[model samples]
Structures are given as structure tokens and as C-alpha cells.
Target: MKGPVSALGINLLGNNVEAAQTVIWTHPKKTEDIGYNFTTTKTITREELNKISKYIDDKDTSANVLAGIATTILTTPLKPYLSISSGIGVTLLTSYRSTNGKLVSDKLKKSTAKSFKVKIAYKYRQTGSNDGYYFIDTIKIS
Candidate 1:
């Protein structure tokens, strides 16, 4: 296929791609189904944070939301689109205060981790066709 590269945009550790009707699998007699799946997330490390900060040197803070919600979105990326790629995302809770004014703490029962997944797709097109790019298979590649 040669129209545009595509991939499953959002991915979790273990979840269906979309509203699953059913996925049928049939191996062509002459070809091997050489596709596999895996997952990765935006589990941040102190070193990574340091590197990021050091590179930018606090130059721009206008779009620093990623740092705030990295842990939540780390396991997901933008939904499928042109030139598909992987990324991390997160859903952040502003504070540990419960709706009823109860206090919660990260050390007690909160997870501050974020992550997303990367999927590798096999983009292909017919020998002379550029408008029919298709993905024969896709696998997770951290």
C-alpha cells in the first residue's frame, strides 16, 4: 500500500483496538504470518526528567502540560492519523483531595506513573499503486 502509513493510535497494556466485531485470521499457504504484538509505556525515570529539563533549560513553559500528565498519558498516544507514530499520555488529578474534602496521599494509594505505547506497522502498496497503501500487520515496539 502507498497512500498513507497508518497504525492503531491508542494502545493500553491489554485492550482491544476498537469496537471489536471480530478479527478473522487466515494464513496464506505460501506466506508466514510474521506479525507479533507487544507494548511499552511512558514510565519516566529521574534521569530522563533531568535530561529533558537540562535540554530546554526552562525556556518555555507555555506547553508544559505533558510533564504534568505524563504519567497518565504515558500508556496511550494520539489516535490513528496520518504518518502514524507513538507517544505517551496521562490523566492527572489536580490533588489528592477527595470530593468530600478527604485527603489522599500518593504514598498511601495513588499511582503517579504515565505511559503510552508504540506500534510498528508494515505499510505497503501494490507495485504500481500509490493510492492503496495498506498495513498488512502491526506489532508493538517499545
Candidate 2:
């Protein structure tokens, strides 16, 4: 397997291997058959979102335009925690509204308790002989 790392990035609960897809690899002879090797890596890690969230949330007000999306796909705990580590320039969007409407950008700046929907997008690249990075997003507050 001298190709890309083919790593798995996941937000887990407790330390159960069956709980999340941490890493998967294709069977040697069965090139097309993929299998998850939970025996190698098994640990549910947490993520840092205070800075990232505030940054993105704030961008919702400005012209920077947040790039990632919140997801209901993986559930951990209420304000559990989030961890994300991937190739540079990964798109992260967690906004209340789709990129639509003309309700005025300035108004978005001075608003509080702005509920947002979840959207997740990323840009990956396999440059040189380096393997791409993995990311895990969790909620850790409450």
C-alpha cells in the first residue's frame, strides 16, 4: 500500500471501536475490498471550536464568508467537543442561512443568538509524497 495514507477522521464516543470509523484500509489482495482496522487506532478525541466557531460566526457578518458546515451526521454529546485537522484551506460552514437573500450584510454583524444550519465541505490534495491530514470536529462547551 504505497499510495495515499487513506486515513480515517472521526468524532467518537467513549472508546468504542464500533462507535466510529477511525481508519479503514483495503484488503491487500482484495484491492477493492476495504476494511476498517480499528485494532491499530482506537481513541475518541475532542476538538477545539471556541476560536474556530467565533471566527466563522463572526465571518457570517463580514465578507470573508465562512467555509465549513455543521453536521448532524455524527453525534457525541451536548457541547461535547469538536476536532478538525485536514489539508489546508478546508471549507467550513456553520451558518444560519444558506448563502442567499439580501437582508443586508451589516445587519448580520450586529445580531445575537443567531441560530445556524449545518454544512460541511472540505478541499483535499495529495501533494508530493506527503499524506493529507485528518480532521475531527466535535462540540465541547456544555
Tell me, by TM-score, which candidate is best: 2
Cα deviation at 68, candidate 2, in Å, is 16
TM-score of each: 0.20, 0.22
> Tens-digit lDDT track for model 2 on 1-142?
4432334444566885432323212224322232211111112212223223444444443323222222222221101222332321223222112232222234433444233222222223322343332222322221
**C-alpha lDDT (0 to 100) for residue 92 of candidate 2:** 22
lDDT per residue (tens digit) for residues 19-69 in model 1: 211111222210122323222334444443433333233332333543543
Residue 93 accuracy (lDDT) in model 1? 15
Q: After superposition, how far is residue 71 of candidate 2 from its true place, in Å?
A: 13
RMSD of candidate 2 to the truth, in angstroms, is 15.5
lDDT of 2 at 56: 43
lDDT of 2: 0.28
